[model samples]
Target: MYNSDSFYLIASWRKEECPLKLSELQSKFGWLLIPAAVLVLVAFYFLNPQEKPEENLQASLDLIQAEPPQQTETPTQNPAPTTLMVDIKGQVAKPGVYELPVDSRMTDAIDAAGGFLAAAEPKAINLAMKVVDEMVIYVPEIGEEAALPTAQPGAAAAGGAKEALVNLNTATDVELMTLPGIGPSKAEAIIAYRTDSGSFQKIEDLKNVTGIGDKTFEKLKDSITVN
Candidate 1:
């Protein structure tokens, strides 16, 4: 409330007074420094941020999708069987022409024919022998004389008479082809065998030719002769 004299007196006191203390200066500015420090801490936290939970989850999903898929295996199938027509007769349960695998035996024919009859003599036949196309399998009755079973499919001559037997010693390729299961290649092979190895000495000697096994011989033996 004083005039210019009071202002002059206050200026003179300030000039003449001792310097202010460090404790007093700190007390006045400490409240302002607290708010400034809090602002600095907030800015630092925003600049250096931590990883988010959503980002970590998304990275895991991307890794799973990028992986390779598993492979599947394919299935395999078995080959079809080569078939042969066989004629079973006499004392079997049901005797007739039957289709069997090419590698079938006499026992297989008997089973295909509904097995042997009660009076059948299975001992009379070669059960373990390999059966070929058009082969005859005869099961004789008990105590009966069984004629030798031979392969003679469509082998009848004119007027119901038996066909003349093929002569392996001098038969031509066309003549050899008349026999069952003898094709052009086999007929030619027979001629080649005879030219290289002379004539067949006996019917059994025909087995010495190439491509002729016991099974092939069994098919040819009944329809061929060397004489």
Candidate 2:
């Protein structure tokens, strides 16, 4: 029932309005897509399981504390006591060699030798003197003359007869020369040795002299004594 002009106007208006509405809907849908993408990323991050750095460190510390402590070892000490050999002779109930501690005194030696006899002279020797290795101790009889040079008793004479032994410490050079294997030169050497090195502490000490060796000491050992 309308004319050609009115129909053309209505078609043009509809075409323009349809294009504007489509553009507005596309802009709105693009904004919604951005928010939806952010939500998906957040969900993926929380879904995967992983240990925290602080938790891993604390677990390592706990494992170390659970182990047992180490034990420290203490060192052991076992020390042996020192000992010495002593010879006790003359006037005692028993006369023999005995083993004694290094700190043992003369009284201890007398006790080891069955104590002194009734005729023993205690004041003749120093009872408080510390005993030495291979030392000789002699207890003289009461009223007997104190032996010259030392408190120790004399050794038996070299001959078959039993006579008072020669005192090496007090004997003259001529007397020393009288012994076997000793000559004037050897006597002089012995006198010089005793003069330089005090009185001999033991018969073995004679071996320390010049020109005297183990073989020479072997021959003289039985003929000498040191108190």
Tens digits of per-residue lDDT for model 1, 1-227: 98999999998898679466669878888798988999999999999997899999999999999998888987877866599887776677897889998798878888999997888777767777777766655555566433333345654221111245889988887677655445577778899999999999998987787767786566447668888
Maximum-lDDT candidate: 1
Pairs that collide, model 1 = none
TM-scores vs. true structure, each candidate: 0.32, 0.36
The TM-score, computed over Cα atoms with residue i paired to residue i, of candidate 1 is: 0.32
Clash count list over all predictions: 0, 0
- State the lDDT at 172 in candidate 2: 70
Measured over all alpha carbons after superposition, the RMSD of each candidate to the real structure, in angstroms, is: 13.7, 14.4
Which lDDT values do the candidates have, in the order given? Answer: 0.71, 0.65
Q: Can you give the lDDT of residue 194 in candidate 2?
A: 86
TM-score of 2: 0.36
